[model samples]
Target: MKIQEKDGTIVDVFAIYWLENETLFLGLPKNYGGLISYKEKNVHVIDSTLNGEFNYFSTHINGIYHWALIKEALLDDIIERDEVAYNRFVEILKAEGRIDPDFY
Candidate 1:
C-alpha cells in the first residue's frame, strides 16, 4: 500500500508485523535488503475504522510520528499482495496463540 505524505510523497508498505491488543503494527523496508530486513514503524488501532472501512494510523517518520486516516482496503491489499509474509506472520500469531484460529 502507498501512504501519501502532506507534500504528496508516497511511501510503499512492505509487510504487517502483527495485530495485537487491538492495534496493528506494520513493517517497512529499512534498507536495500529484502522483506526480511523490514522493521515495524507504524501502528494503529484495528477497530478504529470509520464506516467499518477507514481509519487513522500513526507512523514515525524523520523523527516525527504522524497520523492519518487511510482506507482499510489499502491495508487488505497489502496483506493480499504479500501472501508469503502474511502467512509467516500468521504462523507467528498461531504459535503465540494470541488470536483464535477462527479469527485468523
Candidate 2:
C-alpha cells in the first residue's frame, strides 16, 4: 500500500505487526525511545533506529503509537520514508488490531 505525506510523498507498506508481542517500557530511555506511530490492535512504533539501546522500538513512533510495541512489517529500506511505508504499516497494524483503538 502507499501512504501520502503532508508534503505529498508516497510510501510502501506491508501486512504484519513486526514486534507487537514484545514487552514495552513504561518510562525509561533505555526502552522508552518515544512514540513513533500508532496502528490498530494496540500495535505501536516505539523506535526503529537499530543503533541505540532501544533497537527493539519501531521507527514509526508518532502520536499514534505511544508506548505500544506493535508496529508494521516494514522492509529494511522503507524505514527512512516515514510517509510511505510507515503510515501504511500503521494502518495494517490498526486493521490487525495491533494499535490501540483509543489512540486516534
Candidate 3:
C-alpha cells in the first residue's frame, strides 16, 4: 500500500512484507544477487545533533516502526500500542461500538 504523509511527502516507495502481527518489514534489493546492504548511509551532516533524536527521527522512522508495532500487536493478539498513535484504530472501533464476532 502507498502511504502519503500528512504534509504529502512520500515516506516510502518500495516493496514491503506485512506480518500477521502487523509489523511491516522493508526489504532492500540484494546487491550483486547475494550482498545485502546492511549499513546505513549518511543523509545529512550536522555539526549538532537534531533535537530529541528519536522523536525527530521517529517522523521518518514511524512508517517502519508503526508497521512493526502492528505486527507485534497481531502476534500478541491484542490492540495495545495503537494507543500511542492517538489510539485511532481503537477510537474508530469504539465509536462504531461493535466487535465482529466472526473476526475474533
Whole-model alpha-carbon lDDT for candidate 1: 0.33
lDDT of 2 by residue, 24-87 (tens): 2221111222222223333333333222112234365312122223333454323344445545
What residue runs in model 1 are displaced by over 4 Å at the alpha carbon?
1-80
Q: How does residue 92 of candidate 1 score in lDDT?
A: 41
| Residue 11, candidate 2: alpha-carbon lDDT | 26
Clashes of each: 0, 31, 6
TM-score of 1: 0.27
| Local distance difference test, each candidate | 0.33, 0.33, 0.25
Candidate 2 backbone clash number:
31
* Model 3 / residue 44 / CA error / Å: 27
Higher TM-score: candidate 2 or 3?
2
Q: CA lDDT of 101 in candidate 3? A: 22
Ranking by TM-score: 2, 1, 3
Higher-lDDT candidate among 1 and 3? 1
- Tens digits of per-residue lDDT for model 3, 1-104: 23333344322112122333343422212111110112112111111121111111132223332232253343122222222332332333234432222211
